[model samples]
Target chain A: MISFYPGPSQVYEKVPKWVKVAFDEGILGINHRSGRFEKMLAQVYQLLQEKLGVPADYTISFVSSATECWEIIAQSFVQESSFHLYNGAFGEKWCRTTKPLVAETAGYKFDFQEGLDLDQVIIPEDVEVICLTHNETSNGTQIRPSLVTALRENYPDTLIAVDATSSMAGVALNFDQADLWFASVQKCFGLPAGMGILICSPAAAARAEELQRRDHYNSWLKLRDNAIKLQTHLTPNVLDIYLLQQSMLERKPIDKVEEKVFTRYQQWSEFIPQLSGVDWLVKQEALRSRTVLALEGDPATLSALHQKAEVAGFTLGKGYGSWKKSTLRIANFPAMKRDAIDGLQTALLT
Target chain B: MISFYPGPSQVYEKVPKWVKVAFDEGILGINHRSGRFEKMLAQVYQLLQEKLGVPADYTISFVSSATECWEIIAQSFVQESSFHLYNGAFGEKWCRTTKPLVAETAGYKFDFQEGLDLDQVIIPEDVEVICLTHNETSNGTQIRPSLVTALRENYPDTLIAVDATSSMAGVALNFDQADLWFASVQKCFGLPAGMGILICSPAAAARAEELQRRDHYNSWLKLRDNAIKLQTHLTPNVLDIYLLQQSMLERKPIDKVEEKVFTRYQQWSEFIPQLSGVDWLVKQEALRSRTVLALEGDPATLSALHQKAEVAGFTLGKGYGSWKKSTLRIANFPAMKRDAIDGLQTALLT
Candidate 1:
């Protein structure tokens, strides 16, 4: 069966084979703190850093999922105020998780058709943290890296946290520009949706250490302490990590991976307008995401197409929140083969 | 290589085979909303309830991990006050997570030998929630089911939440008696770490619905709503769930499973005292957990034994927190073979 739903996306064919070896070899039950488990985790993290081109100083902490990372960030930072740039549902959800803290949030809602306008959005000087979703999955809108570049120049003191959940492994991100970056393994990493990889800048770690409030599970300082020993704050998803380690090893360099994914997305962008009663949801070319393509069509026609696609063994993502009826999201992560995309194009045209 | 580290404990031998099937069959990437996923999850929950004897009204929500369940409980139930019963490290960690909204915490430090004192611990009328760890993995202590029964009788209005992280499937737990019970899939489920199964009473759902401010991601209301559709609030650990589903189907009835595990523990308990300079960490036999047998030994001897055991292809759990220097934990879960335990005993004696 072909699955086109954004994530849990497809995994490498070799992953299950490795999982079999992992099981048959009796590595499944080992203590995560043992030397054996530590070596496994270290290898996984090293491979992750190597694949993502994360700087040597940046440390990777694997947690349950990207949603937990939101809590980790809010619990660790946001002691005073956090500025959030919201464009869609996922961004709104991120902003909502920060409710427990005594922090003020600033929201700028950009049109789904346009990229983040750094010039139009204002950040107060006192805002201690600024959070943005690098790619808005709900609407298939991409935030240009230039936005982060601009933030570093204008708001030097503000800690930048990017939720690259749907973009990280599919694109090249500059880790030095952001204080904290995190994503789930399922999306572009082409693994199951169990583990979240979080990279923290030393400055972010220091900020977490200075926080006065007691944080037990989501505490970045506690996580940092554990990371020093190559452990996690709690029992990790070992199998998912194992699969992710294998997936990263199978990935090409960022430039090559990004080029292929971006080109496939460009193909979809150029092909969609040729169809009757179909158009892109995020209308502007520059704003559309390379990994997730949102399409707007007549509601009845989209519904018919969705049912037809499912019957033909392609499962697509529904438009989230307000756009639920009129739109469909197509994922073009590196895991999707060109043949599969070609099949989808043929099916749609038919 | 024999891995004996107590949890992320050893997976069932059949686990990898089923996992490979899940991957090879292309069932791994299906949208959790699809009929296929819903059927798989429904079967999983049904089997779990049957095996665990959950009440008909209680609903099980699958999450990324047990720690995320803690965050859910914190966000959902602890609006006015929470009372945490701490016996060991995991228990202490739970208490630490509750510091933000805790009205007051009743810290009853029990000797590693004794279990929770049901008579001495008082649940205040004002306490909105009562949190406890069912099995203290750190000190190898297990709180008797009688404690929960007493709480339910005396404090009918207060919601009861238990973290059965290391116990659940390893022993008999009365799911019908508790308002909310959650455990990780790793320890007793005979699977790799990633997912958590949370069984919540309708009363707990009502309490969550009453909460004025709930973080969106960890909010029980959102989770419960999503669970109705057999989906999670976030992208779940799909592979873990598949493995867990396989485990649930393969699990023997609780009576037989518990009996087998208990008999193994009995053998260890009877033999542990025979070792020179070694003693049970929990003072009383009644308080010692059947799943995790905590032992206190001379540091030098323990170190020597640990090395010998490692060479003999057996790995043991080190005592966490204060007991780290002098304690060793032995897991007697169903997945642990008798020969492995015998081998460990031989290694220790040598």
Candidate 2:
């Protein structure tokens, strides 16, 4: 079956071949500190930079998952207070997770249905970090890239950290807008879900070094320092890294992949609105995410629709958080095939 | 090649089959909150209890790695000062990592050559947690189980946490002796590196609840609460967990595995002492680890010996930390076959 779950959704078709390559190469047995691993890490960083348009000076580190990124940012950058601009459950989660670590955490919650209006956002003077979710998988809302640019332009001194959990690879992101960008591999990279990629600007690295919180194993400063040598502070998921590298190698260029994903999402969104008893979660067209599309319907109706799709050999994502039963979320990840999207359309339309 | 690198050293021979099972079963695509995942996690916990003697009152949680465990424990359990008894790099790393998080972290370092003697340890009144490394993978030393029992008796109020990273599955640990036990899957479990298992005693859970440090995603309270439903606080490494479950399924009973490991290690240890220009790192026989065996010798001699074994289709672990060039380490994990060990013995002896 073709899986369309939001995250940890689907593996790339080429992954089985890559897994064989990893096994044949004895990838799991390589010491994390060895020259071979260091070389592999360096290549991955290079690939990410080339594919994602990450700045040359930015440092890339591998973490366990996107959730770990929240904790690491709190420990490394949030010395005073953080302003969390949230539109959904995941955004609120980021604020709540940071509340205890920092002295203060202020949250501006947007209406989940309407999503965030960038012009209405206010950045407090004492907030050292501004946390934003690039795409809210829970509500299918996305903060436009222009807002990221606006935030950075307005708050030059404060750090801008974006959780690009669901859209990093499928969407073309302007890496210059944020000081830190993080995503787990499971979402758009079409790999297994054990590792996360953390892209940090030099400015963010400086902020972490200034904080000097040397106690945690994933010290942002240490991660940065070790990252320069193409190594991690811990024994990372080597096989996942290998798989990610191989998947990246096997895929088309990022721009082409993003175009393919956007084209399919656009087609679906156009047809979804025309369907009976179904509407996009976000009222604002521009605010709706291209990757995670949340469709509104009655709870039982949505469940039946999900079952119908499943019987047709297509798995649509379940609605998350408060919308768990009332909505059907579909992931338009890069790994999603054209036929699967067509099948999903056919199953729903019929 | 027969690998002897300590942790992340080997994948069990049956891992390829298990990985296939995971892929074919679509294990990676299941939602973490789904009943299927909950059932799988429950089965894993049950398997662990039956095999490892983890107490019924203990809560099992899965995290990314042992490094993450240090941060979680420091955040969740350490209310005030923590007394760290360290013998080698990993133990010292635990203290160093905890020093910044707690109110005060005190470390008593044992000589790397001599290893830790728990009987001589002194606990300060302000110390709320006593941290020990059940197995110091870096230096091939282990704290005896009796020491864990004695410490629990002596410091009834102080919580005891053990890093059983390299020895948990290859040896029998008394769960009642420690408030928390954690180990990465790469070592004794013979799985690829990516995830760790954290066993928290009910008393430890109580201590975390009393502390109430719920700011982080991996707060012990949050982890414990989620674990009752057989779920993790964040997205876990689903594939690794499946592999671990499969490895456990293929293994003999824990006691039997432990016996086989110990017998093989005993035979190797006997021959090791007789080798020309080679001696054990720890003088005390009881402190020498059953899984990871570190041997001291001239740097050149060790290098030549390592080369000889490699030419004979074997890979020996290089000494870690300061002994990187001067020693050869051997791992006697349960996954290591008898013939492989005998081959190494023959290659070294001849």
Candidate 3:
């Protein structure tokens, strides 16, 4: 079966071979603190740097999921308040998750078709954190990178935390534009659902040092300390980390990957509209996410299409949040085979 | 090579085949919110209940690791402070991890040679949570079940939390003896690292409801809410959860498994003491953990033996924390083959 579901979408076709390599090399049997595990982590970090063009001064750490990063940000950096700019369900969830943790968490919900409007987002002077969902997986929308760059310039003293959950590996993100950027590997990295990557600028580490909340094991101070030693603060998903390194080894830089993603996304973006009873959800062309694409139909029409896709051995992503029954989502990830994408388009056409 | 390392230890021999099954069945591609995932999770919980004899009223949930349970306990239940009774590094680590998050945290360290003495452990009435390490992997000691039962009787009102990281699947634990019991799967359940099991009594759930700390993603209230729906609060380690279900299908009940563990442990208990320059770390026979066996020797002797074992194709567990140089830890987890243990014994004897 070919899966077009976003996040936990599909494993790279080569993953089985890499997993065998991990088994043969006893990767699953090593202690977390062993030198072999440490070297593997170092290599993974180096690969992320080489393949993604992450800044030399930035730090990369593995977490359980991108959702954990929300908790960490609220616990470690935001002493008083945070301001969230969002348009989709995921953005709202992040804001809701943060509200109870701090004195004040204010949210500005932009129009879904309009994307993030930096000019209209007003933040209080005391809000230490400004949260942005770099790509909103739920609604198939994204905050343009230039807008994030502008926001960083506008709020130089405030920490910029980007939920790049669906965009990290498939996009060429400017790490310097945000202090903390997090993503789950199940999305564009083309691995399974388990591990998350947290990229921190030097500024984000300093902020964590300033907060010094070491109560939780996943606290930034503890995570950063262990990550500097090329180890996780806890026993991590070693097999997934190994799979990530192997998967990344087969790829070129993010620019190249992003180019391929655009080509595939273009295939969907151009073809999805022509299908009977289906229309692109995000009316504005510039607002749609390259990785997670959504299409609209009536509830019955969408449900019928979903069933048809399943019977055809193509697993299409179910719509989320408010659009659950009225939309169908498709993931355009780097690991998705060209033939599989072609098959999906072919099935839909017939 | 045969691995005897405690955690991230050897997976069940059938794991590769099961992973192939998972890949073939498209387990890696399903959306986390899909019915398929919910059903998969429900089946896992059912398997755990049947195999472990966990009480009908108890709730079983999965977290990233056993360490994450420490944060959940501190953030959700503890209003004032917690008292920890521990003999090894892991117990003290739990205490230290809890300290910064609550009002006041206290610890009572027992002798490594004598396990937990529940008779002497006194908790202040105001203390909300009581932390215990059922098995101390660092020095290979365990608190007897009877002692935990007595402790529960002594502190009837306070919540009891057990860190059974290395013992849960290997021991026949009484679920009624504690409110919260947690363990990572790598040690006893014999799976690869990345997932943890948290078993909660009705009282533990009540305490979580009363505290209602929803600030973090891992807060007990949120986890319990999602758990009731046969789902996790976040995108979980689906592949690991599936692998765990497949692995547990071949196992018998906990009592039967524990009997085998005792038999295997007896083999090590009798043999390790007879080896040159090695003695049982836990002097009391009753105090030794059935799963993690530690041997004592001089630093040079232990180091030399460690190197020799490497050449002999035996991966022995390393000493940890304060005993880093003078002891060797051997995980006698359930998945270890009898022949592998015999091979280690033969190499040591020669």
Cα lDDT, all candidates: 0.80, 0.84, 0.87
Please tell me which predicted candidate would have the highest lDDT against the true structure. Answer: 3
Top-scoring candidate (TM-score): 3
Q: What TM-scores do the predictions have?
A: 0.93, 0.96, 0.98
Tens digits of per-residue lDDT, candidate 3, A45-86, equal 999999998888998889999999998888887788889999
With a 3 Å backbone cut-off (N, CA, C), the pairs that clash in candidate 3 are none
Tell how far residue B105 is off in model 2, in angstroms.
2.1
Q: Is the docking of candidate 1 incorrect, acceptable, medium or high quality?
A: medium
Clashing pairs in 2: none
CA RMSD for every model?
Answer: 2.6, 1.9, 1.3
lDDT, candidate 3, B11-86, per-residue tens: 8887777777777788876678889889988888888889998887888888999999998889887788899888
Query: Ten residues in a row with the worst lDDT in model 3 chain A?
Result: A16-25
Candidate 2 structure quality by residue, lDDT tens digits, A42-97: 88887887877888898888999999899899988768898899988998998988
Q: DockQ of each model against the real complex?
A: 0.63, 0.62, 0.77
Tens-digit per-residue lDDT, B1-350, candidate 1? 55556677767778878877997777777676667788888888788878878777888888767876776787777775778887788878777677764556555565555556667776677888888889988888887888788768877888989999888888888886779999888888878877788889988878877775455466777778888888777777778788878878878888889999888887887887778887888777788888987888889977877788888877777878888988888777777767777888898778
Q: Write the per-residue lDDT of candidate 2 for residues B274-320, one digit (tens) a residue.
A: 68888888778877899999998998778878887888877788888
Backbone clash pairs for candidate 1 read A29-B9, A29-B10, B112-B282, B113-B282, B113-B283
